[model samples]
Target: MLDAGLLVPTAATGLYQRSGDFEDAVRAVEAWAGSLRLDAYPRRSLPPILPRADFLQTDYLRSFPDLAGIVSVFTGGDAEHRALLEDLDAGGNGSTVLEPAETVLSSAVCHSVYPTLDPAIPDEGLRLEASGFAFRHEPSLDPVRMQSFRMLEHVCVGTPAQAEAHRDVWLPRMAEGLGSLGLDVRIEAANDPFFGRVGRMLAANQQQASLKHELVVDIHDEKPTAIGSTNYHEDHFSVLFDLTTPDGNLAHSGCAAFGLERIALALLSRHGLEPGHWPTEVRRELG
Candidate 1:
């Protein structure tokens, strides 16, 4: 992709400036995914940064602290600023002068959605289609493992049955959608990269309960990459966000998230770098 000018690299690993062609491919993939169910769900557009208070509520720090990207800024006075500059000039890390900002880079697009929902959901439940940028602290040379990426997600909040059904329905649908794009796709049980030993137990329980499933495609010769995922949070967000069903039970949440850049890369890898030259059916589907 770098050789083809589809991706422009920066000094930061896992971060790249996408080309027009790359963005076009991303939009095409997003459009294709949206066409699958956009009309049924209300749409939401959220910022990439989340309120620190809400971030704390999500408990991401407990589960994936290693991947969290906290936004820190210089909130110092003039004297402090001068000292910070002098420190930097003296080869000292200026970050030492920075303080945590009110917001943190969102780890997932869906994290911001939960806070927006009502404390009590209706019987039919709530469903939304949201698209936004997401961030993680992991830095890697692998293009597929981008530290910053765009996500398009369909989120459902309701009873456990509703959440499970939402995940179940979308998992295969996403796999088929990607397969239609001429890429070999598979649906498999997966778990989040939780932190530490306790997290290992959480991950094991998550897998045991089949709470997460991923739509994976081969973008590399070595292994398959997950371009999309379906996750069921059984009252996890509800307990934190204080959400409940109309009947008073805690609400369950499920989401299917599509990694736009990863899907675009998969398409480029499978059907050649040129989108125009991709199979006619694939082009038509993307359009």
Candidate 2:
């Protein structure tokens, strides 16, 4: 259960009345940030919603057009009423429209990250861990299926080896960090939320290439939910952001993100809401 705010509540919402596990998730992100050893992070603040056009270049819109937002502009009452009639008629006719209005709404936290993956990140590479509120206008109201949520991400810009090594190194670190709290975990292949024709082709190629992965955790006492993902965007962001390497070649990129509320659900579903009442060891670890 969730409030209208869609946050795990201390009173009426999901299992836990306290958010220790949620706090631990934050701790996990902070600890991961400490491990990066980078000097400065290019701080970013997301606009209410970026132009759908900017997102198109990232191919996020093309890949997952279903995730795109539909907009209709009206000149006056007649135009508005006509547009409404047309929409109703279209729906009744059961016809699909390959619509291209604005770009697409950002469905994730790092939507602004790529544009900042500067071409000149110097020799060592760029590393930053960020956390923020993210919105996606998908139709999900299950406490687990939230329309808005928090996302924490680590953006990496470097060579392919560095990019791969980045995830290979941190994936286990994150898993180990969570495991210390008694969670079971695994690293598995993943697929994207690609759109129609063009997106289908790109997603197929990405899947075959094994470019994306998720750190699936058995959050519940039963089956698991993907609490986190480690994705390699093999020069996709580099091209879009104009990110470059030592010789000024397009740099490869990757990101690891954590879905905050899902982890809370995991804790409650697995350990129960009265986690503080659990055994000393579990309580201590999460604390």
Candidate 3:
């Protein structure tokens, strides 16, 4: 991509500035996905960072601390600033002078949405769709394993059956959607990269129960990339956020999330770098 002027690299390993063509491709993918559901789900816009308190409530720190990106800033006074500069000049790390901010970089696009949901959901449930930037601390040379990237998610909150149904419905739909773009796609059970030994157990249980499914496509010769996923969080967010269904039972939540950059990369990988030369049907679908 860098050779083709689609992605511009920086000093950071997993961070890069995308070219206009790259951005356009991402937008087209998002637009195509949005068109699949039309206006049935209300759209939401969210910031890249969320409150630390709310983040903590999600138990992400315990589950995926290695992938969490915390926002840090210099909150020091003038004297401290001078010392910090002097220290940096003396070959000290500037991060020493920074403190954790009130907010943390959001790891998932839907984390902020849960806090804003009504305490009691209606019988029909609540559905929302959002596209925003998400961050993860993992730094890698693989373009698909981006440290920061755009994510498009459709979130549902309601009873367990509704949540499961939401995930079930989107799993194949997303697979077919990506397949329509002329990429080989498949749906398979998957697990989150949980942390530690306990997390291993949790991951195993999660996979065993088929709680998460990914739409994967081959972007690299070595391994396939998960361009999208459907996860059914059974009463997880609802318990933390104090959400309940109309019958007073803890609500369940699920989300269908797509990595816009990954999809764009997949398109470039499969259809060549030139968008104009892509298949006519794919071009029309993107439009």
Candidate 4:
């Protein structure tokens, strides 16, 4: 029988603990990441928790203000704590103080990679492999819409043609990679959730320019979830970080990111509770 508690929803909405077959599905996702051998010289590094100033430079705040996760620490000393305790003891609600920290939790896996580069790309280009936890504020009851999740991304930086070509090649491969695991996948043009009224224009331009594409699969309802995305950022990061090609032209960049938890949820939702009974190819690939 399928355990009802496979994914334990936490008190915080959109957060979940993976257990039972859910964990097994995530293991399968790890194997999928390992199977990709496209990098000629992949720059592997630990994920970064970025300084607030660094994150501020990105258009993240402008585009995703509602979803950004700020890191803060309690600024209260013992005296303040005692005052709150006394207030609570006297039947009043306790109050706490929190101050913004120097850093914010990572919102995207590739956000920090560009700043760490050598400032100039080689003639061939650059490829990077990064994996880490990321935070967002899309609170929901759906297990697939996790507020916190693990992500694996392959980033490419070079000329415009090079960056576009890399996404072209990988988009199909990513769909195949997930489909092999028995998940139904589709690739479609999409746009970022740029904030506010002006954001509508930005999103329209983004789609018109064909800057982003997403691989989606049905998880919870008829509305499909975007499990992966391929983005062609034309000089967006290059201008921000002053990145350049060997010949001094502005560099373009692209990335393919896999949402590990969403992939796991899709697998369990489609294949049922038993990982052992998953497709033979998927079991062998995961093993």
Candidate 5:
């Protein structure tokens, strides 16, 4: 049974305060990432705001408009502010003075890499590891479904075969790592939450191609939840960003992304609330 305030609720519905044990588990996961042979250089805290135009180019609006956290601010000048303040005193025009910002809150860390890449990549391709906060407008009280969350992301850009192979290598490796830590883990093909009727068709096609695979673990319920994912976006971002291989073919891109908060929650669920009493192997590896 879940305690009343284990995840201390904040003003936001989907964001919650994490306990100290949860923080330690997140640190352990980061250490595990360092053990991988991905040759990924670490970058921390990607820019919070993304260019609205850049986001639009990625077709995010078409797929996840409902989940986007668009940045809007008060554009009112001094006079407008006073009027708005007066209206606020009157309780009417609080929203009227706000205008959309040039940037939207970032949803994923992977999109940040595309803008920094060269027009063409070398035969060897590129790999990067980054951790950052991302925002989605999901309004759930479940600790696993945070509106603001962190992702430890590993991205690869190369030929189609190379990209897919990268995902294949990491998928099982991650599962094994998590399993050793005492979590029930498995890999399965998956699809994103797309929008509308056309999006349902796109999701089916995506599953048919087996482009996305998730490392799922039993978190809070009978049905398992995905703690990490390996995604292969075959030339989709490449074409959009003009990324190409040495041979001039559009580069294929893939990523392995770990949800830090979700993993921490899983650890607490598996190992009991107290970290000191956890299994010896689990404590040793994390220590």
Candidate 6:
């Protein structure tokens, strides 16, 4: 059960250690991130959670209200809560409803990716690894829904066609990679976290347009939880943040995300954590 907190407390000594499924996921994602950043990767984070002005430009906050709720805590609040809320409230005087958000933290970390873009990466293609802690506010204490969580994403920004192609290239590789570990994986059209009213249209168009795909696992009672996702934001972030291609055309972006906790939970729930008894093949891959 969710014991009323942000990040779930674990009895395991080294949470980052590859001692269990959750830990293994964390470790692997860290490895991937480290390797990617080493090759001159360019990335950025929202100075504050995110300004209401910026989100409005991209319609990102309106689309993903849950994440926005987490961003709102930054606008104003008590010191302790402010520690987590990151000053991203967009609700001050405009349509920014993110002020004093429901939760003092982000419900998920991946949303932070669209908020910033580093223009230095040559536009032939840009590869990036973004990882961070995210919070979601709700009654989801299941080993699956810890209020605060971690996420790792690999992003590629270029042209619309290239963005889709990038997703295509990684989708199968990821499926096979997870499958090697005995995960039952499937791809499907996924929905964005669009807030209310007008934002729904943007989300619907994005979905109908098949701009995103999620790699899900059957974690919660046979209903696959989205562990990995690929999104093609054709000029959404570029136009919003003014990201451009080497050729000076508006760049299109696609991202692949791995929900650290959810993936870890899936690993633990399906396979035992003990390195000795665990499948030798998968264990070797982790090492």
Per-residue CA lDDT of candidate 3, range 1-287, in tens? 98988999999999999999999899999888777673487988789999999999999999999999887889999988998999999999778788989999999989889998878899999899988999999999988989999899989999999898888888888988889999898888999999999999999999999999999887854478899999999989999999899898999999999899999999999999998899999998888
Tens digits of per-residue lDDT for model 4 on 74-172?
Answer: 578898778777887888755344568888878897887787788889999888877777888999877777888888888989988889998998899
- Cα lDDT tens digits, model 2, 1-287, are 23422245443232233245455544544444344433566544454355566676776656665655544343346665666668777774312322444533457767666664556866877877666655555554356655556667777788888888877876777677656655677887878867777777877888789887776776445566787787887887787877888886888878877776666566555665545555566556555
lDDT of each: 0.91, 0.64, 0.90, 0.82, 0.81, 0.62
Q: Candidate 6 — what's its lDDT?
A: 0.62
TM-score of each prediction: 0.97, 0.72, 0.96, 0.89, 0.92, 0.71
Model 5, span 84-105: residue lDDT tens: 8988999785777778888888
Ranking by TM-score: 1, 3, 5, 4, 2, 6
What's the CA RMSD for each of the models?
A: 1.2, 6.1, 1.3, 2.8, 2.1, 7.6
Q: For model 1, give the 10-residue run with minimal summed lDDT.
A: 38-47
Model 4 bad stretches (over 4 Å): 1-3, 43-48, 75-97
Give the TM-score comparing model 5 with the true structure, all chains together: 0.92
Number of the candidate with higher lDDT, 2 or 5: 5
- Residues 93-146, candidate 1: write the lDDT tens digits: 888899989999999999998987888898988898989899998999989999
Candidate 1 segments exceeding 4 Å error: none
**Stretches of model 3 off by over 4 angstroms after superposition:** 220-222
**Which lDDT value does model 3 have at 274?**
92
* Model 6 lDDT, residue 189, Cα: 90
Tens digit of per-residue lDDT, candidate 6, span 1-287: 12222234566322222234345556674564334332467544322244445445655455665544433433535663554444345333332323554333444344455555575447467777767766554434355655555777777877777788878877776776667766798888977767778778877898899888888889744867887877877777777677777777888888877777676667655775443466777666655
Model 4 whole-model lDDT (C-alpha atoms)? 0.82
Clashes in candidate 5: how many? Answer: 0
